[model samples]
Target: MVRLMRALREERRWIAAAGLLFLISAVLGYFNARSLDETLRAAGVWERLERAVSVIRADPTFLKAFTLIYWNNVKAVLTMMGLGIFLGVFPLMALVSNGTMLGVVLAKTAQKTGANPLWLLMTTILPHGILELPAAIVGAAYGMRLGMMAAWGVWGLVTGGHREVVRHWRRLLERIPIVVVGILLFLLAAAAVESILITIVAK
Candidate 1:
């Protein structure tokens, strides 16, 4: 936990940016849920069923985005968006947006359930989020390194010195082990949460 906090502190800008994105997303989700609930209440059974079918049809897009979005959300929750450690501006923006999306989902779920937010969060979110989020962080962390190298490479191209680029890339290569470890832990936890805990709780 201390290390995690340290990691967050070290990557504060990225994490904060992600968190901001989460807040925006949460607000949107809350309204969307409310709108859906209202529709659910007003619709006849057939209409509601039709809406459900529409949702099913949309699931493909959801899944495609969900793969990336899920991990991004997970990263925000864990407060592990540390791309700024390597790259600066772009990474920070990405982190912030990622974090905001996470916050939005959480906030929306809480609002959707009111008093039962924890239960919903634990069951619905804790499942895939556990693995997906961490994997995102690992990816983000690596991206930070790549971004830094790319940025430096560009700078070197305009000005003239490959030293920084080589140095940053070398350090990034060393971080591969850390990313692997982080992703592995995240995936393992997510699998258990999704496959076991959520089912048991839902039952």
Candidate 2:
């Protein structure tokens, strides 16, 4: 954990870049959410999200709900990282899609509350979102890094044959700890806040 934190701290620039990417994605999503159905369709996770929502509504215990939410987020964060080897395309899309979902939800919430969108954002998302968004950005950043490694690995294979590719693979493996540990810790905090603190406040 200490090593993971240190490594993430060292990559402050990358994290900031990732944060900027996240905000850009959110802005894009907000605009796209003007056509909510289209944006949701593009996201392609509405069915799974529906099921998750059902579970959240049905589950009586906070632990069970938290577990469900945590694992789903874990899968998402991992997908962002794993698919990043596709040269970061998937991670960027995921960010945009998620941001779109947030926009749609916040829009609906604002409508229901008869409040401004920014007020709805502040009341509903700002708390856990602070932790969750950075966690996601870290996942995307690492995925983008992995994609770069893969690109370099391919370049190495073409130019230097196997040796350079092997070196790139080794570097990629060494960096996995920072991505995994950082995402896990941040998401855990986000989940706890969303399920416990936010829920309590909402009531």
Candidate 3:
């Protein structure tokens, strides 16, 4: 945990930039969701979301929900981290897409249930989002770092600096495990908090 915090402090700029982009995308998605009649053609999205919410609300076993949600979050974080090596493409897309989905869900739910979107978000996402969102951005940032490192290596090889590039690559590989471990720990904490909060709130 100390190592993770140190790494986050070191890469604060990258994570902050990703978080800003996510917030912007979320705002756009919120506006897009507001005009559901014109913007969304598929009614299935609303139906599926409603069904999922209903299932969560009606389920008796909080442990089951907690486990499922925790696993899902773990998978998402791992996938994002693994995919970040592809020139950071997947990480960027994942962050933006996730933010957009969040906005859409919050807005749609509020509109349907006659609740305030801000209140719904506060009750549901804020608890876990405090950790999860930053952890996600940190994971993506590390992934982007890896992607950038690879790109630099490719460029170096093309420019006849192969030995130097190889050295740098070795260093990056050594550091990656630390970042991965930190992200996993963060996600675990986030999932636990989210599951507990959601279960309590739902009940």
Candidate 4:
């Protein structure tokens, strides 16, 4: 636990930076949803309805991969930005993006329906959405932490100002796989929830 805390502290800056980016994305989503209020009201929201439905109907594999890639890319960006925190940002980004996606969906649903919209979500996404969203978000937060560690580790190597740099760098390298596997595990949890839970709820 102490080691983990140390790791987190060492990579705190990277995490903070990545968090800002993730929060920005969420804010963008909310703003877009609110802007579409007029458009949705004008179009009777039926048009947007099809597009929204298409999100599920379209090539699920492609959608999943695209989404996954989006998260991974952000993770990579943050990790690189981290300097030597030795964190893997891919997993972190995945989690954050998924959470954002779910938030967008939930927000839109509530806006259009003027209520909780929990029934629809329960039928269409629950069970799985619940599992998947949490897993992804947790994975993302952890991944972001790892990426920052990698960044700091690298920074330490170059500057060699701090005695703890080398030690932390090695820790970051060792932690990468742990973080990667952690993300994958969450992905699996999400998948199971989506597959079985979504279908059952729909029925």
**The best candidate in terms of lDDT:** 2
| Regions of candidate 2 where Cα sits further than 4 Å from its true position | 41-44, 161-169, 197-203
What TM-score, over all chains together, does every model reach? 0.50, 0.83, 0.80, 0.51
Give the best candidate by TM-score: 2
What's the lDDT for candidate 4?
0.53
Give the poorly placed runs of model 4, Cα more than 4 Å off: 1-32, 36-100, 117-126, 201-203
Q: Which is superior by lDDT, 2 or 3?
A: 2
lDDT per residue for candidate 3 within 1-203, as digits (tens), equals: 67656666766788788889889877788888766433443646556556756666778366766676667677877788788778888888888877777788777788889988889889867876877787787777777777777788788989999899888778667666787787677777876776677777777
Candidates 1 and 2 compared: the better one by TM-score is 2
Q: What TM-score quantifies how close candidate 4 is to the native fold?
A: 0.51
Global lDDT of each candidate: 0.53, 0.76, 0.75, 0.53
- The digit string of per-residue lDDT tens for model 1 on 1-203 reads 45544544554564454545544654564546555445434755337446644543455343433343435345543343344444545555555444544444565657656856567767776565656654664455545545566777888878877787777667656655555556556664664544353334334
Clashing pairs in 3: none
- List the lowest-lDDT window of 10 residues for candidate 2: 194-203
The superposed Cα distance between candidate 1 and the true structure at residue 77, in angstroms, equals: 14
Clashes of 3: 0
